[model samples]
Target: MTRHFSETEVVAILDDLNPARLRSFVAARVVTPLQTPQGQAFSEADLARLQLLCDLSEVYDLPDDALAMVMSLIDQLNTARGDMRALIQAVATEPDEVRGRIMTHVRSIRVTGRG
Candidate 1:
């Protein structure tokens, strides 16, 4: 079973995080937690994201909007990486000739800067 953290526990875990800021982050949709009968429950992923947000805010002094934009870009990049991994796995299952052809096409696109 996955361990879920309450808001109080999350605040205690992250040094730079406070109740007000956590609430603000949630309000901004930066760190979404699961709602349960007990109240908001944070996953490990949420904990890591909260840490990252604290770093971004403290180190870069980013406003909420800027943080949201940065987070969105990060999320998009992660999605693209997952998609690329899936494509690579699919290509790996192909015959050698097909794989070679695909690699050649990819190299040509890279060389021509067309992709």
Candidate 2:
């Protein structure tokens, strides 16, 4: 089972995080936490994102809007990576000739800089 942390636990775990900052993050819709009967619940992924947010804020001193944009780009990149993984798996299931043809087309596209 995935471990979920309470708001308090999250604040405790992240050294630079405070209640006010966390509230701001939630308000900005940057780091979304699960709303449970007990209160807000954060997953491991949320924790990692929060850590990254903190690092970015400290390093770049970016505003909420800029941070959100950067996060959005990161999300898109991750989704594309996942899609590519699925595509690779699907292609791997094809017969040798099909795979060879696919590779040839891919190589030609790369070499000619065309789709």
Candidate 3:
């Protein structure tokens, strides 16, 4: 099981966000985590997401709404990737032309259904 981060650990991981950026992300509701009795609780995943937001801020000069849209698209892409990884692994285990044939058959099935 994944270990939950303590507040100190969370701060250590997230301290890369300078005070100004941290305020911006919090204001944008992009840095929210579960509040625990001791302190704020952030999943490790949030660290990665925050890093991506920081990168977007640096590279693209993304405003709040644009950053939100980019993050939303990132979520969509990540979901698609998870689905595709299993498919890709299955395809890799197949014989060389088998994958191609499967794609061909799928296309044919779709074409027939459309007709």
Candidate 4:
């Protein structure tokens, strides 16, 4: 059977987050923890994501707005990755010399102050 995490377990996992920030995340509905009449519960994914958020917010010192921007960028990157997967399916192989030539040209352009 699959396992979900409890709120306390989630809290314990993300020891870097302040209670106030955690509560704010709850209030923001960034993660929808399961809740009973007594209290809220969480999934393992929620715990993991909370830990990641704490790392960004505490260790990286990102403000809430900056975190939101980072999340938006991540979503965009995920979508781009999906698109890239589909595009790569059609490619046979990239020639190494061709790739190296493009890189060399790009470097030469940069050195010569050209776009």
Best by TM-score: 1
- List, residue by residue over 1-115, the lDDT tens digit for candidate 1: 8899999999999999999999999999998999999999999999999999999999999999999999999999999999999999999999999999999999999999886
Highest lDDT against the true fold, candidate? 1
Q: Which stretches of candidate 3 lie over 4 Å from their true place?
A: 4-16, 88-101, 106-115
Q: Provide C-alpha RMSD values for all models, in order.
A: 0.9, 0.9, 4.5, 5.5
**Model 1 — TM-score against the truth?**
0.97
For candidate 2, lDDT tens digit of each residue in 24-89? 888899999999999999999999999999999889998899999999999999999999999999
Which residue runs of candidate 1 sit more than 4 Å off their true CA positions? none
Q: What is the Å distance of residue 9 in model 2 from its true position?
A: 0.7
Instruction: Give the better candidate number (2 or 3) by TM-score.
Output: 2
lDDT of 3 by residue, 1-115 (tens): 6556655665567655665676577678876867778766667787788788888888888899888888888889999999999898989899979988988887998989742
Better of 1 and 3 by TM-score: 1
lDDT of 1: 0.97
In candidate 4, which residue pairs get closer than 3 Å at backbone N, Cα or C atoms, i.e. clash? none
Show the lowest summed lDDT stretch of 10 residues, model 2.
Answer: 19-28
